[model samples]
Each structure stands twice: as C-alpha cells, then as structure tokens.
Target chain A: MACHELIEGHLQALARSLPASVVEELRDGLIESYEDQLERLGDAEAAAHAAIADFGDADTVTAAFVRASPGRGIAVRLLLAGPVVGLSWAAALIAGHWWTWPISPPLRLAVGLVLGLAVLMLIVAVRERHHYRTVRLAALAGATGVAVLDTTLLATVVMLPAGPSVLLVPALAASVARVLLVVRAVPEMISDP
Target chain B: MRAEALKGHLDGLLLAALEDGPRHGYAVKEALRDATDGKLDLPTGTVYPALHRLEQAGLISGSWVVVAGRRRRTYELTEDGRRSLKGARDNWQEFAAVVSTALRGAPWPATS
Candidate 1:
C-alpha cells in the first residue's frame, strides 16, 4: 500500500475506538510525525513504513494518545488537592488550638503572600529553565512545592499563638492560589513538539 | 507516487469521508479504498489511532455499535471538524494545482 493509503487506513481503524474529534487530532499529529520522518529519510515511503513499524502498532499509538491527553499531570493533581489541603489545615488550626507566632495577623498575612508568591516564582522559574524539556523534573518540583507549602502552613498555624479565626482563612486562600499556580504550570511543563 | 505525497492530507480525507455520514472503522477503510480505486492501501491497524486523535481534538465524535454479529466503532464529524475539512480541502486544491503545474514542465510563478 502507498504511505498515504496506509495512513488513511490506520486512521479509519482508529475511528472505531475513539471519537471523531480525537481521531482528527491524532490524524494531524500523525501527519506531522510522518512528515518529519519523511524529511529525515529523504522522503522515502519505505523509510516511513519502517519508522512506523518501529513506533509500534496502532493500538499502542492510540493508548499513547490517551495517556498524553491533557488531564493527567502533577500540576492538575496539586490543583485538585489544594482546596482540600487548605480546608484541612484551616480545620487543624481551629481545632488544634495552637499558639500564634510572635508576629501580628497583618504581618503573618504579608509573610504568607510573599512566601507563596516566591514559591510560585520558583516553580515557574524551574519549569521555564527546562522549557518543557524535562517533564518529570518539572512535575517533581511542582508537587514538592505544593507539598512543602501545605506542610509549612499547617506547621505555622500549629506554632502560632491564638489569633483571630479570620487569619487562617487568608492563609488557606493563599495556599489554594499556590496550588492553582502549580496546576496551571503543568501544561507549560508538559507541552512539547 | 502522488498517493505517497498525499500522506499529509489524511486528516482532510478522513473529514471528507465522515462528511458523507457516520461509518464504522472497517467501512471507512473500505470506502477510502474504493474512492481511490485501490491506489491507497493501508494496514488494518493505522485507522484506530488516527480516529482517537481526531476525537481528542474535538473534530469528531465516535461510539461503538454491534453490526452483523460483531462490535464496531462508528465515527462522525463535529462542527470544528467540518470547518477543518473545508480548510483542508482548499489547501489541498491549491497545493495540488501548484504541484501538478510544476510537474508538467512549467516554471513556478516565482521562477518564471
């Protein structure tokens, strides 16, 4: 079969198991893949077929498409986990009855904001430094930052002397934002040609 | 061969196929083969992945149905898919014109 025919046939086979929208996207991606491979191999059809064979069968490729679909990232996980962690820490502060730090409420809020933003910046910087070239590293950094922020906020609340219940709300809110930042960063991290 | 050259146009062809109506995977393959007079031949395996990718991009939707005592997946285009197909069709026309002109011993406009 000609390369185009083979690709069309493969695409039709894929349509069986997926929605048309997804099949279309994969079709575009596959075309790009084939074009790139063809260029590398001097536009030889035989070379393209060999490359496809090496890449594995259609089912494997379909599963890969499913796996790479946007939702399954550490950033998304952190985003989802953020509100729960925030509420948990707020509950802990309320129920645990810990002393407030020597700092006043306004100072604590300022500190939290600065720390949160700094952590957000660090996460962004680490991610940008790699330019989505190291997804695992980016995911690890994002998850770690969120985890540390969560832990620190919980610890600070436990250490602080009694303060207005209102103070915990802002801290919780800041943590939630931090989590969102991490989640949003995930797409940038995983996006690659 | 021109068919090999047209490999990049598979998405457009798929959208065109779905334009007629929804069809299952095997049927789509058979139709394309018939349309091309057997010029385009494909392994039985390549179509499924391409279909899934298209679905992911919101260009088409698909579902499974049992036909003739066997299960098969059916696919159809979405609004976005229709728009994309039109674009692909226009591009392919222009591209084919240029390539055919070049192949016929005519200088490209820029070169001429």
Candidate 2:
C-alpha cells in the first residue's frame, strides 16, 4: 500500500481532534507501522488492517492527545470564566467609585494588552487552524497574562484607601481565585508533548 | 493486557524501549511487542501520547530522520531518562520481589 493511502482515512478522522503537525506525524507513524507489518504479514491489505488496528480507534487516540495537551482546555476555561471575573471587578470598581481614583496609564495599558491576548487565545484555542504548539503557546501566554493581571490588580486594590472593605471584597476574591487557579495550571501548560 | 493495565508502568516500558537505542514510534511499538512476546500488544492510540509525555518530562527527546526514502520521528532517552530508567528498574525489582513473595506464600484458590 502507498504510505499515504495506508493512513489517509485515519488522518481524516483525526483531523478535528489533533493539530496538523500531529496529524502529519501520525500519518507517518501509521504508514511505518503498516510497512513493518507488511514485511511480517506479507499481504498489503492485511498489513493495512493490522497497522490501523494497532494504532487503535480514532476516538481513543484523540482522547490521548487531548489528555497530553492542556492548551485548548485552559483557553476555554479562562475565556469562560472571564466575564464573571470581569463583572466582579467591575461591580467593585463602580461601588468604590474607582473611576475617580488616580489609576496609572501604563497599568491600564497593560490590562488592555493582557485582555487582548486573552481574546487571541480564545480564537486560537477554539479554531482548528493552529498547531498544537501555537495552541500551547497561546494558552501559556493567556494563563500567564491572567495571573499577572490578577496579581497586579489585587495589589492595586490593596493600595487603595478602601482596601479589604465590603465593596471591594468580591473583586479581591475573584482575582485571588484566578491567581490560584493559574498557579495550579502552570504545570499542565508547560507539559508540552 | 488491557491498555489501562499499563497506565502507570507505560512510561517505564517506553523508557526501557529506548534504553537499547533510539527508535522511531513504530519501531518502539515493535520492540515492546517483541519484548513482551505480544502480551504488551498495546492499544495503538496509547503509545504515542505516552512518548510525548515522556518527552515533555525531558526523559526522552525526538528528532526527524530519513529512512528508506521516508522521514520519520525517532526518539531516544536523555541523561535524565537514563537515570529515571535506572530508578524505575530498581523500584520494579523491589516491588516485583515483594509481590512475588506475597503471592508465592498465598494458598492457591480452590477451583470455583
């Protein structure tokens, strides 16, 4: 069997679940396994069958890749939790009349950039267009961005005159929770396959 | 054996596969199958992800190579991988010994 013919169907089945690079690698792997089997089995048809069988089912393989890569999951999670975290901070900001506070320009710009990065991460993670590496990078960037943003925001909140007050409590708690979650996810983010 | 049966030890088995030398993904699968005499016939999906995980941990590294007119990814153990394998070997020996002793001393189960 031609190598491409041997694994084309498998790759197509895996197209949605895995990145292009991984799919390409898997294609090569399947073909190689088929060729090896052919040498032993001495029949092209049987070799193809054995090779695919040896690689296992598409869903099972997809799950394995998903387990190995935390990029998409992290991005989805951060994005999903975004509005709640933002709203909590917003409620506190409004309650405390934060607009009247002397917030630094660069700090605001930093927040904007981090928010933009979060948006980009969402698109990259949800799209099938990017490779696993890009997804991982976007996710890591998103996580790190959120963690820094939360920590910085928390620090600024603490410095305010109404620090730790009832009005600011929700914002403070949200930032702290986000920071903790990011800390726990750092290992998974870096565990690139 | 079932794929789940090899979960914790799969990494160790994969690391051992590379102990002899670098091999491509399929070759590694063949080596394991040969070593276990088909007992280790793994779920085809299970092996690659495990290899990736090992690579992430810095225990193994993969590179592309041309073989017989085709490009393939080959993997080899790193220094860390070697040390880890040594540790795994020692641990497995001790574990197997204890289990062997325990099982050896147990009375045979009566036929159901």
Candidate 3:
C-alpha cells in the first residue's frame, strides 16, 4: 500500500480505540510527517515506502504517540501532595502554640511563606525532573524534608529561649539538597530513551 | 527516518501545505508528495505525533470532517503557526546556505 494509505488505515484503526480528539491529532501529525519527508527526498516514493515499512509500524508509532502525550507520574502526584501536607503541618504547628500569641503570629506567617515557597519549588522540581527515576523521587523526598524542617524551625523560633539560629543549618542543608536533586534530574528527564 | 532531523523544518512544510487551504491527514500526505516530486520520505505514523505536538504548542488547529463516508482529521495553520513558519523558513534558508557553502569548501562570509 502507499505510505499515505498505510497511515490513513492506521489512523482509522486508532480512531476506533482512542478518543476522537487524540486520534485526530495523531492523524494530523502523521500527515505532517509525510509532507516533511516528501519535501526532502524528491521522487523517492519507493524508498519512502521501504523506510516506512522498516520503521513505521503502526504499533510502534502508536506506542510512541501514547508515550509522548504526557502521562502523570509518581513524581507529579508527590508534587501535588507535598504542598497540601506541608501547608497543613505548618498550620497545625502554628495553631498548637496559641499561648505565645504575639510572637507566634509573625513567626507563623513567615514560616508559612517559606514553607509555601519550598513546596512550590518542590512541585517545580518534580515537573522539571519528570524523567529521572531516582533523582525525581529524591527531590520529592528532600522537598518534603525541607517542609518538615521549616515547620519545626517555626516552632523552635517561637518556643525557644534566646539562642543562636542553629536550626538554619538543617534548613539550608535541605534546601540545597532539593536544588541539587532537581538539577540532576533535569537532564535525565529531558533525555528520551 | 528520524523525525528529530526534520523537526527544524516541519513548521514550514506544514504551513506551506496549508497555504492552499485546510487539508486532512491523507490529503496532506498526497499533496506533499506531489509538491516535493517524491523526494522526502516520511513514515505516515510519524506525522501524527508531530501534529499533536504542534497542536499542543498552538501552531496548528484541527477538526474532524467526513469525506466520502470516512472521517478524516483536517488541519490548518494558526496565526502563530504562520509566524513560526516564516521564522523557520528563514532560519532553514540561512542554515541550508551555510551548510551548502561549507560542503562546497567555500569560505564563510563575514556577514550575510
């Protein structure tokens, strides 16, 4: 069969199994690929057909299309959960110390913002690290850890006596770790196997 | 054929295909074959993913149409697609020129 006919046949088959919009998009993309190839080789239909026969099996193409469509991963789910859990813990920590009202309010607000930012960064890191299995998971863990540390620091700053801000050590450490994890994950996430 | 190699020039080819008006997938393939005199050889399956990516990026829009008792997906260039096509065409021309000159062992021009 002609290359176009072959594609049309596959597209028709795909339409039977997939959503209309998705099938349509796939069809259009396939057509665009045909046009692009036709422009490059000039009168090479037989060669095109052979190439398609060798490399353009319907199953392989469909699999690639499905993979390219961006399914959510564990990292994404963790990213979503991280913020909710982090903020809830931060809120609870602040609320648990009502006796220290005057001092607690400002500290609570500050910690909330810091925790929120950390959570947001975690979410971004997960997204940016979508491809790396280990690094993405590690970044998620680190983000959660930082959020926990921030919550603890808020409580410490509110309840402790005059002392050096020693909690800064772990807080900074966790933030750096999250950033490093995200950076490492980026290249892996973008590299298509 | 690796689609990655063609990625740089796809927008132009797609836009140029659409300049005649919207066309469905099969028709686009046929039109491109006629236009190129059959030089380029792309697999039919590969185009669909690229089309979806383009649509997602807002370079093209598509709709379903019934023709001759079959449903086919038709596509057209968006305004953004046109702009992208122009940019891609210009860039491709410059790139092709440089590559051609280099292949022919010509000195690179200091300025175009």
Candidate 2's displacement at residue B109, Å, is: 20
Query: For candidate 3, lDDT tens digit of each residue in B1-112?
Result: 4556777676577667777788765556567667878765555565665666676567889777765444567789899988888888888899999788889977667896
Model number with the top lDDT: 2
lDDT for each residue of candidate 1 in A124-155, tens digit (9 for 90 to 100): 53333212223345455546556466656656
Q: Which ten residues in a row have the lowest lDDT in candidate 2 chain A?
A: A125-134
Better of 1 and 2 by lDDT: 2
Per-residue lDDT tens digits for candidate 3, residues A1-193, read: 1356666666676665444666655554554555555777654464445435633666666554543442213245446555554455445444455355455577567766766665555555444422333344444454554545544655564566523444444443443444454455445334431
In DockQ terms, which candidate is top?
A: 2
lDDT of 3 at A6: 62
TM-score of chain A of 3: 0.30
Q: What is the TM-score of chain A alone in each candidate?
A: 0.37, 0.70, 0.30
Q: Supply candidate 3's per-residue lDDT for B47.
A: 61
Q: lDDT ranking from best to worst?
A: 2, 1, 3
- What would the TM-score be for candidate 1 when compared with the true structure? 0.44
For model 2, residues A1-193, the per-residue Cα lDDT tens digits are 4664646777788876676656766777788778888999998878888888889888878767765676766777778888999998888887778778788888788888987886787667656342556677777787888888888788777787854458577777888888898898778677523
Clashing pairs in 2: A54-B44, A55-B44
Off by over 4 Å in 2: A4-6, A70-145, A154-193, B106-112
